[model samples]
Target: MTRQVRRLAERTPPQRERYADLLRAVAITAVVIGHWLAIYVTRDGRGFQGGSILQVASWTRPLTWLFQVMPLFFLVGGFANAASLTSHLRRGGNAMGWVLGRTARLLRPTTMLLGGLAAAALTARGLGAEPALIGVAVWLASIPLWFLVAYVAVMVLTPPMYALHRRAGLAVPIILTVLVGGGDLARLVLNVPYAGQANFLLAWLAVHQLGFAWQDGRLPSRRSVALPMAAAGFAALVLLTVVGPYPVSMVGFGGERVRNTSPPTLALLALAVTQTGIALWMRGPGNRWLRRLGPWTVVVAINSMIMTLFLWHMTAVVIGVMLLYGTAVMPDAMPGSALWLLLRVPWLACLALVLALLVTLFGGFERRAGRWAASVGTVKGVWPTALTIAGVGAVLAGLLALALAGPGHHGPTGLPVRVLVAYFGGVAALGFVRRRYSRPARIAGR
Candidate 1:
């Protein structure tokens, strides 16, 4: 880790905005730790039962507002991608090539995760494990994959979105926020069943656009600007939850009739605004703190294993549950009990250790892929960039199918065969594709 951090720190350009990297690392790590904290697993002979603290304690719902970090991720993603795209254009890179490179980085660690789960399911089944148990394990382990689907879709759409950013500026997120409100109305007030789902794209896109505003200086970094923005967001969130139809939790915990996360309602947009405000407000102190080599080194090191951490985190939890909880090494106390709360410290420690080992083993793929230059690889015989899109499409389709199908020993290779094909085909496309500079790239000069 020290060697890796030294290398990364050496390559860090002095002008690079380190805060964005800090946010990215913080966001992804928080989510991983949050998952480990929320999920509770126990064994009943041959069966495994899992539930979250939210199922037991209702008062914790309000805490979701503080712990939910997905919005912050989209915000920072916008900041990073905007900078990256601008840099790519300055280097005479094509959009297709950019899409291919970004998708590959996102998908590389994902492939390992999916592949590992599939193999684990098969091995468990062949060992005479109950199908229901296998299914539960697989489903629980794969929960984090949902983020990749949304994130990849966003990455694929960046070029067009960036173009819109260039033209519309802050109006984009505002319009998106209004649309998200409309979506919530349709889903809750009018009973339009699937209307809320649209915000999955609309809300996040809006948040991403805010990142663009931050990047281009339209979103000012000042106490005067950020504090009011945060106050307004906090007010709106309270109104939406307390006075309006939205639930209190930013996440979809049990007992909530509506989930702010599943489709990410207008309330989440409000939460995003608040988080953005706070993040911007902290920029000055954060920037100064990060100027020191030691602090910046920690940020870079964490950022380096980020994808690995996000992808394998839940897997690590599952393994820890089976090895520790299943073997009775970690005692199970009632959910939300004093003992249960106390036990979680060790539980988290074990999960983190397992996760570290996973990263050490599988992180090589992520590191190698991360070091890849930001351009499409060129091939001699065919149009690889075209295939890049098709591949990404297949990968997305496959991931969606797998999530819909749910993981288990019920299908070929422990998952639906179609999903396997989609995933493998997509990975192949991105891996084999080639890059060719085009006039369009020059036209998009920074």
Candidate 2:
């Protein structure tokens, strides 16, 4: 593994933005570790239950500013998608084809995760696990999908958004940001129902548009730009949370009256801007640091299976909770208590071990999926493009349904009929398209 990483590092192009890769690696790592730390598990008479540390330690809410790194993911995603799409277009690829290729990488691994969780949920049911417990368990496991719902949508929109970026430059994000602000205002001040939902796309699209700027060199890594941008963003963030009715916690927990994240308020966008500025500020030194073989090797390795690690980290937590808390191997130290704090080291270590094993087991799927995606040729005509769009829409719709309605919502099979059909049908459609268009693999004789 080390040798492979070293080789990858050695072969990396000098023009590549290593800092962007580093930021992606850092963002996903932060999310995994942050989630593990935030989840507070305790065994109850009914079964094991989990809650967020933020609920118990209100002081910890403020720390979410540092830990809520989803903005960074979308930001980096925008950068990556813009780059990938441009390369594809330059190679004379169609927009739909590029969308299909990019989304295939994401959807492939996601399909595996949902399938695995469903099978596990069914097995637990056969063993007489309570339905409610199963539902909660599946819900917790699928929490990562909530972010994917937004990401996949934004990803699918990238081709069009990038086109807009080319024409409008910074004005695109500015308009999106204004719309996000209006959404927040409607939801908060007017108490309008579901109006803030627009920010789900607008806010993320806004952050993503910034990535386009960075990619095109419209947003530079200069002290003058970075300093004021960061300062103004930070100021807005403080003001919104402290005085403007938004919660201090950037991450949403159960039962929060107002969250910066769920619908994504202006406060969250402020964090995105703040993070964007900070990322730009670090680009100079960070890229230079990544030039070192050792650092670059580590970043390469992490980025290779970053999605797998993110998707399955919560499952590792669930497994650890079941094995330890279920069997009374883990002590019931109340969250925020001294003993709980002291036990965090071992707790984290145990979760890490479980996560490592899960990653080792499932990471191959991601690698193979990427290989498959790479092998497929671009779609040429209207029919194939339509097929690709329909397939992607079905997949996203199914994923959103599962995320909203737990996989265990229907009990024994662990998935609703429509959800299973929609998801698998989409995967099958994509598979068919790939097989039809795939370039033949090199053979021994060839």
Candidate 3:
């Protein structure tokens, strides 16, 4: 690990923003820990049933305020994507090429996650595991995966959006945000079914645009500027949650009639803005601290495994619980009891150990994806465009299927049969795009 960190530190561009890496690490870590803390799995006489500390402990709803970190992700995503695209265009890169690169980077590790889960689900069934248990296991393991769909959707739109950014400056995000507010009105007030789904992109686009602002220096680092931004964001959030109908959670609570996160309500956007202000305020200090070797080394190492770690953290929890209970040594404590609370510390530690093992084994997919960035095809004109659209559409559709259906959900495992077919078909469609339509070297250079 030290050697890996040393190599990363050596290869890192001097002007590269270390703060982004730090933020990524911090965001993922907070999410992992928050999941461990908030999820309260209970074992009734009928094996394991999933529950949440938030359900039993209402005080923890406020904790979601601090722990909800998805906003930070889009904020950072917008920043990174803009900077990357701007640099790529200067080097004469094409839009399809950029899209292929980004999708591959995300999907490489994703293939491992989905593929492995399918295999595991199959094996459990072969070993005579019950379908209900399999369903719950697959569902909980996949909790982290839904984020990929939203992120990739936003990523696919980056080229045109960046163009819009170049022309309209900050107006693009403002317009998107206003649309989010409108969506909120439509969904909550008019009771429109699925109207809020639009904000899944619109709300995130708003935060992502701020990333553009941060990159171009339009978002000033002045405390006066940041403080007021924070204050206003905080104020709006209070109004929405306290005075209005929005839930206070930055994340969705199980069984809640209204969830701030599942569809992304206006209050969550308010939280994102507030977090953006705080992130900007702290950027300087964070960067300065990252200038040193030791701290930066940890950041580099963590960033290298970022995708693997995020994807597998929940799986680690499932693994830990199984090993502990399956062994029949550790007595199950009633959830929310003094002993149950006391056991959480050790439980988290065990979960971390398993997570480390998973990362060590699967983190290579991310590295391989980085090396395997490829252009879609040699075919020119709308042919390439058509293929790119089809490819992305197929992948999104497969992911949605997987998100909706658990892996190996087919009475027997063999592959999360439907999901495997969907996701693999999507990947093949993408691969077909690259092979069948790749730009020839001669014209690509031109």
Q: What is candidate 3's local distance difference test score?
A: 0.80
Write the residue-wise lDDT of candidate 2 on 336-384 in tens digits.
9998888778778999999899888888788777766655546656676
Question: Each prediction's Cα lDDT score?
Answer: 0.82, 0.84, 0.80
**Which scores greater on lDDT, model 1 or model 2?**
2
Could you tell me which residue pairs clash in candidate 1?
377-434, 377-435, 378-434, 378-435
**Which lDDT tens digits does candidate 1 get at residues 1-446?**
68868877878888999999999988998898888888877667646677887777777778888789999999999999998888776667766767766776878788888899889888887888777777767777778887878888887899999999899899888888889889888888899867878787888899989998999899998899999999999999999888988888777866668889888888888899899999999999999999888889989888887888988888887788878885555776787788878888889899999998999999888877775644342222246556767888899998888778864555534677888899898787677663333223444443
TM-score on alpha carbons, each prediction: 0.94, 0.95, 0.94
**Residue 57 in candidate 1 has what lDDT?**
73
For candidate 2, the 10 contiguous residues with the lowest summed lDDT are 437-446
For candidate 1, what is the lDDT? 0.82
lDDT, residue 32, model 2: 93
Off by over 4 Å in 1: 326-328, 373-386, 435-446
lDDT for 150 (candidate 1):
82
Best-fitting candidate, measured by lDDT? 2
